[model samples]
Target chain A: MEFLSYTFMRRALLAGNMVGVIAPLVGVFLNLRRLSLIGHTLSHVALAGVALGLFLGFFPVYTAIIVSILAALAIEKLRRDYRDYAELSLAIILAAGLGLATILISASRQSAGIHSYLFGSISLVGTRDIYMILPLALVIIAVILKYYYGFFYLAFNENEAWLAGVPVRTLNVVFMVIVSVTVALAIRVVGTLLIASLITIPVAAGMQVAWSFKSTIWLSLFFSLTAVNLGLILSFYYNLAPGGTIILAGVVILLLVLLVKKIWLLLRRDL
Target chain B: MSFLKVEGVSFAYRKERVVDDVNLELKQGDFAAFIGPNGSGKSTLLKLILGYLTPTRGEITLKGQPVAEIMDWTRVGYISQQVKDFNQSFPATVREIVGSNLYSKMGLVKFLNQELEKKIYRALELVEMEDLINRKIGNLSGGQQQRVFIARLMVNDPELILLDEPLAGVDIRAQDDFYRIIGNINQEMNKTVIMVSHDIQVISKHANKIVCFEDGRAYPHCSQEFSYDDYIHDLRRTNLRIIPRHDH
Candidate 1:
């Protein structure tokens, strides 16, 4: 309780909780649309951006933002042009970004940049970083809530939505942009390596028991907050990496849900 | 003028012509079925009508205006054969699925308030699915899914409804219910319906008109003299080898 009185600890807690909330909220749609892999791919692209920023003498966050948006555009264009081979296109972009990062890192004079981005140092997060991430997360969440129906329609059945005048192409671009923004904002807390888990695990856990779309979203948000808060507390106590621990906690919870669901089914049959 | 006029329309995939030199017209409030064996371009023609595919030659006009110039899409509703293509485990409620039709009408920035909620309830009620509004789409049976899709279509208040194989994979009781529901939509609402069906016997019994497809062309059969027995005999005899195997 004494530790919670510190401003730094409070700031870290707030930031971690915000990220945990936003990631899974967006993730419910991402998982449904089968775009979970995009999270991983964009995080790797951010890694390249961070490495490039170190070499070019710019703010890594700004570089990460630019690189992530570019990756999103490339993904959207690739999917449109090669709709039949979209998966291959995603793989190619992911590989290219990672390869660029590897080359940049090998030629760099300093190694601190790679280490910081790989394993996020949440304790080192500044007030400036919090200010940047908070509004971005808020705006993205607000936009998503406003256009929930359009996104749901487009994700479920694109052709039917198109015929009903849903501006399918524009919505697709907007959705990709949202994903890019979330990945960019999450980099400080979750890092590039395990950010996708923050997006995927909560939704996976919620799906085991959710019978409705609205309930599923709420459940995902609950699981995500629990994992992040718990993981942060454990990390602070044990002096471990917050992002990795949070992701592991989420996975464990998801497995437990699956186990419980299976047991319930078995018990019902026996009766 | 016809409610829908498709003139000299020809469509091809890559280099293979699927609908060749075809012409069709449907009057307002007509309930018509397009029937044929596999790959006979029944679905292709419907796609052309819905503006999903471009014709290599000629144009499609809706109510005297060219379909390309028509910006109002709320006037049309469509249901595809691939509703089951969605992930069975996707997290969406039956109400959400039905309510999705309102997106285009409400635009992106609008919120779904109490009035809209009432409309969603009404739409679900029409399909007799009001009680299952909170149920996940994945949990519903095939017929139920089709009904939910119908409820989605109804919210749009379309002048024309295009359905692709709505009866496929639905059980007999569900099919009867579907037919009755469609009958009510046509008779009560006076909405034009164009459907693609393989059940020639059922189509003969229920559909007001039939459009037969063979060798990449569509021919309309007048309901007054159309015989179910003769039509079945001709269909079975003409395409014996290509007939798909039936499980039941």
Candidate 2:
């Protein structure tokens, strides 16, 4: 009870819960649209932005958010310009961001902040960080829930959606923006290296059990909440890296779901 | 005024003109079919009318208004070939797939609610897929998937429906059923339909008008008495019958 009373613990829980909710919500569509790799790419772009901010003596969060949005726009434009080879463009951007991040980190004399950003330390989460993450998470959730059908339609069949007047292109841009914001906000908790797993694995696990699209989204949210909360608690207890632990928790849950699905199928066949 | 007018339209892919010097017109509540051999510009012409591709030189008008200017796409519905361009593992139910058509009508600001749910089921019922609302789209048979796609087109309640080879790969029984459904949509709903198909026999029975494409020009055929001999000759010369089968 005393441990729960600590302000830092309360802040960490709130921040972790915020990211836990937003990542998987976006992840459901992300996984469906085969844009799961965008999360990883944007995270690395955010890291490069953070490194740049560190080099320039400014707050890394603002720089990270701006850089992520730019990266998102660049990716969207590249996809449009090179529709035939969009994946190749994504790979190029990802490589550029990662390569630049490595160079910036190596060139810097100040290594402490870079290490902190590499593997997130949730103990460093302050009130301001909570304030920044909470509203963004809320906004992302609200927007996605409000336009669930649009995203679903766009993901399921883009050409059909266009014919039916779904504003497929504009909705695509909006979706990418939401993904950029989610990745930017999630950096504090999940870090850049493993954030895609945090977004993807929970949905992968949820898909195994969910019968309908709506159920899959809800179950993904549930899995995310469980993994993030448990991962946060375990990291607190064992003095481990929070991002690494959360991702590991997600992977473990995915494995369990796959095993359960396999067993259920075998048992049904036997019966 | 014609319900739809396509004038002087020419479409090309990288300097290779696929649809050249084409003109077409459809009256209100007409059932029309576009037929051609392989690469005869049937699908390309449909794409131009649907605004998926820009005509290198021409205009398409719907209800006497330029299609590009009128952004109200609720009046236009489309079903493409059964190509399965989507991943087979995609997670969408039959109801969700059909309900997606409502998005354009309902707009982006609205959420899918009970009213939308009812409409989706009603659309499914129209195509006899009310029983399979919960089935995953990928799990259905090819015929069943075509029915679902038809249901998807139905949800919008469009005045004009364009279909690209709805019977491309289905069994004969399914094809007959599909043609019956199209007849009902045209005869009962009075919706204008323009389908691109190669089946002359089925089109002769179902469609009120037919347009055959050969050598980049469209030849309109309105009567059932038009010789299948001409079509077969065009098909042999242009080799339109050799459709590249898409791997599902």
Candidate 3:
């Protein structure tokens, strides 16, 4: 309760929850599409973008969004060209992003700010950060609502969607753009290093018990909100890293769900 | 006029031409089966017709309209060779899987209506899977999963159904049932079906027309007797009366 007295704590909770919702929402598709690594890879691209922003003396978030989008497009191209070894494309981009980020960080000598972003500093969520996240969350929700079924169709079977005249290529491009924006928005709260876990952990928890696609999505939201809210409060009291704590919270929930499922199965077998 | 026509169509993956100058025609209600050895382009031809792959040097038309130009894909349903390639751990119920057929027909902007829900059940009923609509798709047997996909295809009332190795992983008993269901869809529903299968004997039992693919060119097999030189050559080696191409 004392933690809520501070304005930074409240802002951190708000921004963290926003990332919580959007990251897992996007993560469900990423995990289903077997592109969970894309989040990790793009976050690295976001780092390079941040470093570039510092070098150019501008806002890092905008630059991160631009760089991540371009990197995402490049990843898509590479995936098409090397369909057999698509993961290699992610590895390539990740390497390029790391190299660029390292060079930029050394050249700029902005070590403190970069370190804060690399591991995340929830205490630093300002008014501008909240403003950026709110609209991002809404846009993500709206896009998901508009393309939910089409996305579901593509995830289940891409060729079927194509044959049915679904605008697959266009949808894929839209989806990649959303992913780019998501990576940019998410790095603000979770940090670039922990972005993958923030995106995937909640969705992984949901998959443990969800029986249907709709339920899985809803459950992912539930897990994400719960983890983010709980993690924020816990971190405030314990002086812990918010991003890592949130991920740990999600992991705890997943393990609990799996244990319950196992116990239920064992009891049923015994009966 | 043929409902679907392929004229002088050739497809190549880079420099390797999989299909070469193939010509074929299908009327409104065709139970046409494509058979060949592995890598012989039967599936590739199906993809070319479905507009999933473009031919390097020819044209494919569905209902006299070029496949590339046809915008309304609700008329066509495809169950690809990778039908079973999805993550079995994916959390989707049979009803949800069947309902996805209506996604393209209804567009993504609209919510699922009661009418679409009723249509989903109707499609499930066609495959006698109404009871399992609530079941997790991954929990079902291979044959059941295949039927659910068939129901998914049927939900939109597609006039042309394309199946690639629909029975590739099913048990023998289930395969027979699948063939019957497909045959019924072709005969009773008056739907045009183009199927790719390596099981020539089973396909021959049900299909009205069989096209054997050899080295990118399609050779028609209208007779019950094995007459093609490749077929005769295979027959000699196997010493069996009915040896499927890939099996031989």
Best candidate (score: lDDT): 3
Q: Model 1: per-residue lDDT, tens digit, B162-244?
A: 99998877888999889888888988888889989877777677777788776577777744454555455556766653334
List the candidate 2 regions with Cα displacement exceeding 4 Å: A1-3, B12-16, B54-58, B222-233, B239-248
Give the per-residue lDDT digits (tens) of candidate 3, residues A48-105.
Answer: 9999988888888889999999999988888777988988889989999999999998
Of the pair 2 and 3, which is ahead by DockQ?
2
Which lDDT value does model 3 have at B135?
93
Question: B118-200 in candidate 3: lDDT tens per residue?
Answer: 99999999988999989999999999999999998898898899999888778888898798888889999999999997677
After superposing candidate 1 on the true structure, give the runs of residues whose Cα lies further than 4 Å from its correct spot.
A266-271, B107-110, B222-248
List the candidate 3 regions with Cα displacement exceeding 4 Å: B7-23, B39-41, B55-59, B108-111, B219-221, B227-232, B235-248
Best-to-worst DockQ order: 1, 2, 3
Model-by-model lDDT, in order? 0.82, 0.83, 0.85
Put down candidate 1 lDDT per residue, A1-271, tens digits, no spaces: 6659767767778888888888998898888888899999999998888888877877777788889889999999998899889889889999999999889888776757678678776786789878878888898889788888778777787656776677788888888888887887778887889889999999999988998777888999999999988887888888889888888889889998999999999999999
Error of model 2, residue B23, in angstroms: 3.7
lDDT of 1 at A120: 70
Ranking by lDDT: 3, 2, 1
Question: Where does candidate 1 chain A have its weakest 10-residue lDDT segment?
Answer: A107-116
TM-score of each: 0.92, 0.93, 0.91
